[model samples]
Target: MLFVSTMFESHYIGRFAPSPSGELHFGSLIAALGSYLQARARRGIWRVRIEDIDPPREVPGAANAILRQLEHYGLHWDGDVLWQSQRHEAYREALAWLHEHNLSYYCTCTRARIQSVGGIYDGHCRRLHQHADNAAVRLRQQHPVVSFYDNLRGEIHADERLAREDFIIHRRDGLFAYNLAVVVDDHFQGITEIVRGADLIEPTVRQISLYQQFGWQTPDYVHLPLARNAQGDKLSKQNHAPALPEGDPRPVIIEALRFLHQPDIGAWQDLSVAELLRRAIDNWSLEHVAENPSFSNALR
Candidate 1:
């Protein structure tokens, strides 16, 4: 139960959190650009967070590469970059609070059993009083949120079974689960809005449920349309999507602007990256962005 008295919910505070799985690609650029413009358009604060918790998936020097890529595209963020790896103490303290309050329990449910039960976890272990030895921890879903509102798409809902399940907060492999860490970090960072890709929309309700459990404010969410390739697969590092070019960000920036359905101003070719960013920020509008997934030759 990590609670905060101060509310940043009144003002605009946005963040772009990227995992160090690999360098920034075209799809990731859309997220960064959209979040940056959304914050700057209101003269609000924009922050960056390095989500490097999953060491198995992280690449060497990928974090630095991401920062460099952002700089190359003139997507400057405000304040210090918060690293998830350094926040283990905070996560520990939160888990401790939940345990003390009887709001969480340990479970040793296997993946095969979960799949046998149709993949959504049941509360079978909630009343079993399972031991903590080599077990994962799950939060007691006191108030499951089935639906939430999106800034881009309205009135979003989650699967009923998923919303009602006792979701994991700590993994059996001795790492904090993403749902728990993300909610805790967002609260710690005082984020008032979350702007990311549409692929993440399904987790919004789970995150909101966690916020409710913590008695903290839930931030606004804006899930930008995903970028797809010619074959219709969403551009992703897993798909070995090509990384953004290091030289000359001008063309890609213009293409990204076009992908978002923003006005090009007919002089993007003559403007420097910084000036183009300035113009784009001034003209950025969430309403103007496309609702469908964007497909283009833009470096993803």
Candidate 2:
């Protein structure tokens, strides 16, 4: 379950962590290709992580299918893929440490209750001193990060109220929260930079806060523009975005390159997938990427 390699010893490490809720789609391809190029350009290790922590949302065989799609598009990874399902003990240990150090407390507040209080938790349980049965665990917000430096954007500030909230680390249903798992795994994998979609930009501060709590260094981040359909909805499984088709992936790769504003060396029609990828990696530039999400008719 643990992957150890000289790849971790590299100066830079980038990863594409996807939840296997559905088949790999165009939006995800854009993200994967962007991250892959960023890593390959710097001679850094690119890794893939299957975020299978949420079982209810996952399709049965989607993880293997995703790996196949990545390979089909020539987005080769550096090591064995990491599955969050195989890392429960690590989360348990982390939770234990937080609880023992009084850095986390239990909460029994339901969704409706939080919604009634303007949708932001007011640290109601932090004062009650009650560790109720089957309660969710929340980290105490001592050092809330209101802003973080993005590799592309100079300084992005987060909503002060949201940043100050004592966010959940584990759910009442016994599932580890995304922010906690991502921070822990990013550190575990020795990630130096995170290149993901712009939709996740809001959570960057929360993850950075976790790094501060753990006394660990935070990685650099670059959030790429989100691909949206005609109606302005982001291309995602919940919105029913179509999966990457089974065929020659050159054209789609070229489209993704254009989406990121990367230069095309030669005519893509005359190039193979491997060759196109080589050119893309050779010409990758983070400075060319857009700062905000975009609505594209091609994604429609």
Candidate 3:
């Protein structure tokens, strides 16, 4: 289904939802600066959301350190931070809505079973109506999104087979999956614009479908290119990307701004944190940003 809604009024609400898997790295900074600058460029409200729903994957004290690093780098977010872990009730409500409307089902398929078949999940349990207590909550693909238009990247499409697959909403272990949580959270916050990493482009289709299922408005999406490592792997916690330095954060912040295509405040290497951000905010521009990935090892 390809239903297009009018733009999200560029009243511009942008956000950076970082997982507390480890400390913020170069990739994290790129996404942060990109979203922040884009929001500032439109005179929008930039918010911070901590995606910490999976307790086992979260590193102790990592969330606090992330907030500290953002502060040190002068990425001031509006409003209090929203934590996914604290919003289980909201997730529960979403799940219940799906269940009542026959939009969701319980699946007992194990990872091995799905892998043996293929990475794509076949709707093995869609007709069973299995009890929710002993299975994972899966979103039935009632209206799969085959294509959609991205603000930065034109007309995007997903693999038809994968797009039609029934993806999990709540894991068998009982935690809300990322797709479900992110979609619900965005709606809860009344997010108007989503400016984040380009890697998320593929997932936007499914998330948009969920929005349609729930009769909620889909926000405008702008996916910025990723930060790559020396080997060209995406800079991520899984790749052992180094954490941001706790010392003076100006140079790194400047690099992030430049990477985002925002104007450079010359020789900001010696400027105070406040002054650096002042120049950055004054000169922010999404048009200057590169549409391709920026490789770096500074934030390793």
Candidate 4:
């Protein structure tokens, strides 16, 4: 088993990567606040990455809007924002390396075909020797990852079949897969920790597998509880969740802190955002965060 150290080191680098498909909503704020607080608490670098690889789904000015929202909430990140759209060459290089090592193969199976097989890929094209034309590239799951450790959630085990499936690295539409791009970017950024929502817990195993394949160090993970609506649905762009308020981010910030189960800071209501953040960083504790899937009263 590959052991990941949770001890704070000088190379502690964390990131908050958000897709530019929509504006920053409350759910997005929870993730951003958790990541920012975790990085600041550990005296690590907090970086932001714009996941704009999917051009068709991206909004025209969502990326800039996200940055402005973060600024408004005083969630300033370190260094220049890394845009995934600009890192295509790096992903291409990584894919080429996998192919060169015979760790990847061209897959011609369509979504319908996969659905016919109960939705899990059965390595249909592993030995088909299919050409790359009109085919997606899949990583051969030689050492399948079944489970991984989360700093906050303990040991998380994934579905056995899904863990061992030959998943796509490059889509048939010539776009990079989220799993592939995230793994490549995380490794490239030298990320020491990943602090995001609990909804992403399942993907941790796959990412660890990718790290091992590339002979890279895997980072520690902390999956924060997701903020959900009263109807038990996660607050997301698809759900038409309202975006963060444009001005006076104090209320939202306090609400987010309360959602995380942090100590009450009503006294800091009149303080500046910077001061509140400083207090938050000093008082942040992963142990205080709830482990449930959703916080029902998060928005209240």
Candidate 5:
């Protein structure tokens, strides 16, 4: 068990970072609720971050819509929302540091080439000394992470091929990769716990390796069960998941609680959002959440 010291509890910081590709959906609600409840339960800070690094994927007004939805659900966040687009300089500095320490290299490999030689990259450009003008920047996997532990899912082993591959930090198009940007931002926010979805479990080891490379502390991870659609696909913006209802968010919030397997509190249905959330935080228990992802009936 991961022991939480009193000092740590006093400084516990968690965040809900959603990519602004679309409006908040049922799955997004679950993630935001879990993180918010966890942070508020411990008297910690719950922050919101708009991951708008990829302009092509981001919806022009989705960030504002997401914030409005959070407010509608009474998920008030602490401090200003951190937009990834505004943190380019920080990512650049981190990338420069890695380059100076010989921890990163420029890769000229294309997607087709990587797919031709198995899906995982084989570090073809690790020793090529290629120029960065038109190439992507990849981190040299000096100390590959084989496995890591999750607070909810327990032990998780990394894929051998993925663990050893030289993953990209900066794309050839000059956009920062998710792994690089996430690690940098999490560390910048002094996040003590990461409460997210199980879909992101695969990247835990890679993030851990990055933490090791940068000599930063790895935050505790709690991957909540994902909410899958009737088609067995995880509900996501790319999957055309419907947006959260605009008006009274009571039903949606209750559904989220049920999804997390929290004890029934049907009588509290008439309470205000703040009161409902207060009761939820009081009775929140990680043990109640199922280890496996659950099918979401919100669409039905």
Candidate 6:
């Protein structure tokens, strides 16, 4: 078992796990910057994890570009980066444990069938005990989590309707789902705190429940507001949010800091990355982050 030290638990360890579906955009930068500042303020370790397990949706050069973008923005991470694709064995081990405990079961339902019967996934496979020969796996949400606390947003809770739904852990195509992979990774990395965008708030409760099931300590969570577009839609790769400019990222970085409610240290148009980040770390504040799901489209 991955035991956390009392001292480390009291301190902080934040991460920004980004998918490699496209180059890092303004929204992605906001998340990274927020997580970076939080870690730096607490003198904690900041880590980056490449969620590249889904090869089918991953863009070829996006992963390298993301790393380059982080470097350009002066958001250096500690230790070697952890790639989810390279850790399939660990996921399998976790899955085997769940299977042995009878907490997971095979699911072979299709999307159309699911939609035809209300959108929630009913526990059709909970007692099937069908082997993994030709079935996906799902976590039986017997002890669903309805609420959890967020350090920034205060006591936030999940929709009980959503919480009780059994969710998929492994897909029909044999690929691991985000919920399962992320749980395993966080446990392995000993993440003490999670500082991510508010859009992910819905999944936090379920993840917490998973941690409880595995007898692991749940990390503190801070869900920062999401950056939206002019259309009031969240900026994302699917929404065609433009990638961060290729060279001289100072202007963009400074704007992102301001968006996070940090005071303008100085014009970063001419500053080196080291200078910019030093000022950022010194001025990071959780109070600066707004407690809402959306932010103005000022990054554009």
Query: lDDT of candidate 3?
Result: 0.83
lDDT of candidate 5 over 1-300, digit per residue (tens): 011112233499999999999999999999999999999988899989999899999898999999999999999999999999999988998899899999999999999999999888998898889998899999999999887777776777777778888899999999999999999989888899999987887787789899899888889998887788999898999999999999889889999999998877768768999989899999888878853455221111
Model 5 global lDDT (CA atoms, 0 to 1): 0.87
lDDT of 5 at 89: 86
lDDT of each: 0.87, 0.87, 0.83, 0.88, 0.87, 0.83
lDDT of 2 at 83: 90
Clashes of each: 1, 0, 1, 0, 0, 0
* Model 4 spans > 4 angstroms off: 1-9, 291-300
Q: State every prediction's TM-score relative to the real structure.
A: 0.95, 0.94, 0.91, 0.94, 0.93, 0.92
RMSD of 3: 4.7
Off by over 4 Å in 3: 1-10, 291-300
lDDT per residue for candidate 2 within 1-300, as digits (tens), equals 232212354489999999999989999998999999999999989999999999999999999999999999999998899999998888887788778779999999999999999999999999788765879999999999988888776678888889999999999999999998998888888899999987898888899998887777789988788888999888999999999988989888888888888876677788888988888898989888753345221211
Candidate 2 or 1, higher lDDT: 1
Stretches of candidate 5 above 4 Å error? 1-10, 291-300
| Model 3 Cα lDDT, one tens digit per residue, 51-149 | 999999999999999999899888999989999989998888889888888899999989999998887888888898688686999898989988777
Clashing pairs in 6: none
